[model samples]
Target: MPWRDRISELPECLITKILSYLPTKHSVKTSVLSTRWKNLWLTVPSLLLNCHDFPYRQDEVILSFLDRLLEFDPDSRLLKVKVECGGSEDIDGLRDRISTVIQRGPQHLDVESFTEYRDDDDDNFLYPFIDYIPLSLYTSRTLVSLTLTYSGLQDPGLVYMPCLKSMTLVKVHFLHAADLEKLVSGCPALEDLTLIRNMNPIYADEKVMRVRSRSLKRFRVPFSHGKRCRSSVKYTLEIDAPVLERMTLGEDHYDIIMVKNLTSLFTVDLGIKFVVEFGVFFYPGDLPKRNEIRYFLSGISSVKHMIISDKTVKAFELYSNVGMIPKFNNLSRLEAVFPFKLLQFLPAFLECCPNLKHLILEVYYSREMEDAFELTDVPQCFLSTLECVQLKRIHEWEEEEMKVATYFLENAAVLKKLTLSLTNYPRYVSDEEIFEEVNKVTKRSPACHILPDWGLCE
Candidate 1:
């Protein structure tokens, strides 16, 4: 058939919807495509602008674009708007543009590096210090999803975003606990929330952050890696979400944690970095910290799937030495990373996860790893419900590591599959040689099949 422009024949609203997905720069370029598409770009109802997408003078170019784009239809409601600029010198221009768009009623808004600046005195760190934001943003009636990076949030005297569902604040500063609490409280319909605090030395003071919401389902506080110089500045996090399904607490230490009404919580990522320095493992003397750890674990004892980091494993070992680790009778899937030395103590930790069905144990080496250890007793999961085990990240094919595999093979009566994912193999050892050695381990479950994975090696 002869060439036919079928797309152009679609309704003008449909064409505008298509243009909304393209970058504002690309959308404007469509003006030259045809007479019909010329003014159509102006009605896109979305602005997706990035400084790098333009030529030199990133700030000036974006500011100019925003000035004209908003001026074209200043009263129209924006469905989505994203403004990402790298320059900090002329950040006010970007913020003004953002504030202007917020008042125009945007459903989804994302602003990154909007206020990140560096001081000459502190050449070591780039401070994400935002002094103010449009109060209208927190009370946005049309906003459904909001993401602000490198920004500061002031207590917006009142917050009532009736339609907002998801919010992500990365390196965002809140004047105090009340500012965050106020912002979260205003979003009545928020379902997923992620708070990644700025690691600036300024926010090192002790503070309490409470999150209470009825509609929230997923919440996360990812670990922010910075100088442990302010490790002593502890935070007390309090959460009261009745229907929350998933939560991730990645801080190295929390002085006090209160998680309430997480009856619906199913999965948890416990990447708690026990307040301890590197190379020093024994914290037997810190009974208060031990109590804090036990208290936090007790709140989420019903989580079905759990992920434990290496630092947390050490904390578990320490707590296990002093007292009982919280029992997770409901946990079915468990993923944990352990140093070579902590392998012997795995049974002690697993004893609490009596109903675990799937286990992924990642073995690695650390300089601070203990020299001598003893496997006290076998866990109940190994003999009962445990069906699948994945021993991954195996760097050293040492005798003790092999014994760990044999320990599971000889104990997990219900195990159906055992996967060995190897990493960092010795130059002299062959793949067949390694597999042959593992195959020799006596299996307690006759139906269990052993599988070797070389993907990690590649």
Candidate 2:
């Protein structure tokens, strides 16, 4: 083939489009392809960099490459900038350089640094662009989304971003919760916010900070702190967002007062710690008790879909008054782990949520059952609107298990499918025995399938 013909056959625009998805390093290498490709990377709309992508000693080379790319088209509208680097010294230098670049103000910035090693004297070894966030960059009105994952971040004051919409902070240490509250309040149009960290003591002078976003739609705050620290501090969230639709409460230090006024919520996920005795303590408390478990669930009266962790299910029985379980007239989906003893609450739940169409039971045993045929309290009537039943971990078809299956088959008039998970099979009950019992118990299902590994069911 003639060289001219080969060149003519190639589409320069198509080649540039393909190179746009490659990392900045690989994209720059395209310059060596031909003179026509020398400036191809400069026109690329996205840039991503990580210290691990290239040799550790090549920091200068990486920095020079980024500088040349930015210089090539200083006016270009960058859509994304991702920088992930490690090592304390590399991070400190990188932080300074990144701070300078951020001052230029890209529309989107995602910066993460993970280096746990410290100097021999116990002082933190700072890496490039790791310790401090470029405060000047937060003031940029052009930023639409920003995510930062670092070790310790002190208070970031009332930094305003008129056009900012989404913000995510992970492993950030705030000097005061008010600083975080101030940052959220300053984003006039912020819509999404996520915070994941352990508990820190609230400042003495800091008032309970309330977040008020007129355009906010989703909020998630997961606590990864262990039991020791969580039990001591009370974390409170004050939200005044009329447009809020989805909320996820995670971690142990969260305050129960935040959800009381969220009148427009549609979906809620509560990650409450399950302790039977702890739950019983709040059964007779005030209208909206201080109990973290009950207070979180009671606020979402209008939710259409609800997810409660296994811990929350075990704790529900602690409340002597079943009436505390909020009504969800519009609820259609419910996912929860069921304690064997809590099986009795199924009937009451069905009565409350008449429109529920799906029920997912993640059965967790208290201990190994010695007598497989022991009967437990199983709901007698099947939910009329239930169309599908999913049972996880069906090793043994004890009398209680058979009674539960038979009740559902007899009462679920509109039921269409039943799924059984045979995880850890034969070890608990022989497959032959479980299959025979299921065949005898199930009556109105159109299809029934057994999955040895429940993870594959989805």
Candidate 3:
């Protein structure tokens, strides 16, 4: 047999695999390559179409392209399909074409609209005139991931995706928060979800914002404020995901009540907001209760790694009992921006985190006051398993810094390495000073390394 005849014997799976990586137009062009390749594009499992693939001067060009592609393989079961339109001609016809494509039971579908030039009347064309995402698309038992970007999703409640594992909604608005909650609750197998309210004209109040996902492992919700709305809406998020592993609460200032739920979480990133309010002047004896500290610590007991900002430390301490702090028994890694109050509570805090190994501290600097807090004695609650410590922003090798360094050098039995970073100035503590301190303390430990400018290492 000739070489051409031998090449024609390649398996269909290999041909489909080759076509899957190419653009939709390129994949479709393979139909004319040979008689054997004529129907190969029909079996391709993914389809992606962009406006630049066809000439935009003619309004019917895209429509004709879609018709031809669908006609070739109207019954193909696609794993993913994406269609992005550029010009505005017949949106109804486009929706019908999309509905026809989605009816083939694509496991993943994305549809978005784009234009090179901004139209003065673009605001009028923002709403998606399409009625629905046809029940046939959602009823597919194989659909695992679905994303709708910049599409008008008026009624997300009517759709139900049983096998959907991950979903992202960007610039999409729902008629009601309950409808959104219903949509999330309906997905029994959903593991990751992202809802981004970016640049939406419609605004909902605090009470109307809600979320409830039982099987969700990761959730991120970011809201953008318009000029008309200067203040952000506050809402209470009652989460009940028992199997959640990672969670991120964005820059929304609202009380977070974890309900002591989520036993499977390993990482937590909380963006807490703090405010000071003036009320009736009470006697110094009438102070606030300290249960807030207990509440915050109990919420993150299962987290092994935590990252907190500076502003939240004071609020956390104020809400806790006068002398009691939550014990983070399993905590191994911590990244925080330390405030003066947190520094003062360090001895008590480290006592609870007995298993801490890696500590990354980003110290805040203020010109209003000198270093007032000092660590006079070594902390007795030092971690025996502590290995590495990365200190950032060493201003002047203050009393607190020296005390922390000396305590770690003396205590940290298994410590193997220490990295001290100095910023904003050069050589606050000379090499002689560091070596002298190490000679006085660290008798049997690994070498201490100092990086004058740690930012350059990255």
Candidate 4:
């Protein structure tokens, strides 16, 4: 029997549904396959175009494709539109395309403008000069999720996005700090907000980054280690989210953080270097700034789960020395990354978390460490509430880790389980040997069981 082309006989809606998964460029190619698929790409519900997909003079090609795609069916149900534009001088063309997409009432829009090359040594390199986009983007009523990278946002006079639930701004230049504040305030349904400000010189100059939102739930300022602005000025992070649940703060420049009305905070992952000035260290002489850090800690003290970075542990160690550590009575699960040298101060840091039940310790290597501080008294959590302890991400096991394990096993009176996972161990020792050595440690709690884990065996 001859083939009857059963696939092409499927409903148009189903055909477009299948085409939506493929990029618009690839989807358009299927139009030549058969007459049934000729106009299917136009109503695919998604227009995902990338400048890299097209060869030489990519910007013009991208604009041309978008023009044809959008002009084909003005009322087509474009659920999402993602435009990844490589380094280009034609910013207006990209903005025009985005404006047209906004008019089509897309639910999701993601645009990323990547610079081709950046010369750190070149004094003329101004880091991709991108002008502000069209005002229609901010006024998008149908956009549920919007992600923009390496872009500039103009003065948001009257921002309003009623359905926007998630927004991510990566290195987006804002004319004024109030622009961000107004933009966030206008989004009534915004729940997830992320700001990647590693390359923003304006943020450092503004000195204050206020994130005030009532409906925001999960917020994050992802780790920007080596990617800080060249400006020497430090910034302040003022957060006033009444209903925020989870927040991740990862930056070194925002030394002074002011948080308020975070009543529903469940988890907080912290990693702040607290280097207020560019070249200045956070010395003990700086009492006012140090006190501000205390205020920031007390603001989120009610969080039930906290994942702290190794830098935060160092900050906590410094705060502990000056008696600036705040009590985290509500914190039940505490995960902290500590370097081998900082292991000595873990006990003192734990003293602040009196009700901590679970402890996840990830130890790494560091070259520079502060002078050792020894604590004579045991942490209150270790003696009472702490039950489960997991030692993970151990690149190399050393004597300091063993001492920490011994201390936890001997002091955690109610400890029920202790799991250890080793990765990239030294060529000399085996996992079995490390397990045997850890097993020899004395357990104060009779019910304690030691378990060894080989994480995700290759």
Per-model C-alpha lDDT, please? 0.79, 0.65, 0.63, 0.79
Q: Per-residue CA lDDT of candidate 3, range 351-418, in tens?
A: 66778888777766554656477554434335465677777766666666766677666666666666
Native-referenced Cα lDDT, model 4: 0.79
TM-scores of the models, in the given order? 0.85, 0.75, 0.71, 0.89
Q: For candidate 2, lDDT tens digit of each residue in 161-247? A: 988889888765455667777778788889898876434432343335457777788988765654543434455667677778998
Q: Considering every candidate listed, which one attains the maximal TM-score?
A: 4
For residue 195, what is the lDDT in candidate 3?
68
Candidate 2 matches the true fold with a TM-score of 0.75
Go through the candidates in order and give the clash count of each: 1, 15, 4, 0
Q: In model 1, what lDDT does residue 347 have?
A: 85
Q: Which stretches of candidate 2 lie over 4 Å from their true place?
A: 1-16, 52-54, 57-65, 90-96, 103-105, 114-130, 151-162, 198-211, 222-234, 253-257, 274-292, 320-323, 348-355, 370-388, 411-458
Q: List the residue pairs that clash in candidate 3.
A: 290-320, 292-319, 293-319, 293-320
Question: Which digits, one per residue and each the tens of the lDDT, describe model 4 over residues 1-458?
Answer: 99798879899889899888888889989989988788788889998887777877566666777788888877776898888774655545777777878888999998886443344566865444555667888888899999988777878788899999999988777777777889999999999999876344544345677899999999999876554434555566789999999999877646577899999999998877666665344776678867877888889989999999877777777767775688889999999998767777877788889999999988775535545534356899877899999988655566656766777777788888888877754545678777778777743345889887776322
Q: Which parts of model 1 have CA positions greater than 4 angstroms off?
A: 1-11, 51-64, 91-96, 113-131, 201-206, 223-234, 251-256, 276-282, 365-376, 395-398, 423-435, 442-444, 454-458
How close to the true structure is residue 263 of candidate 3, measured as C-alpha lDDT?
81
For lDDT, candidate 2 versus 3, the one ahead is 2
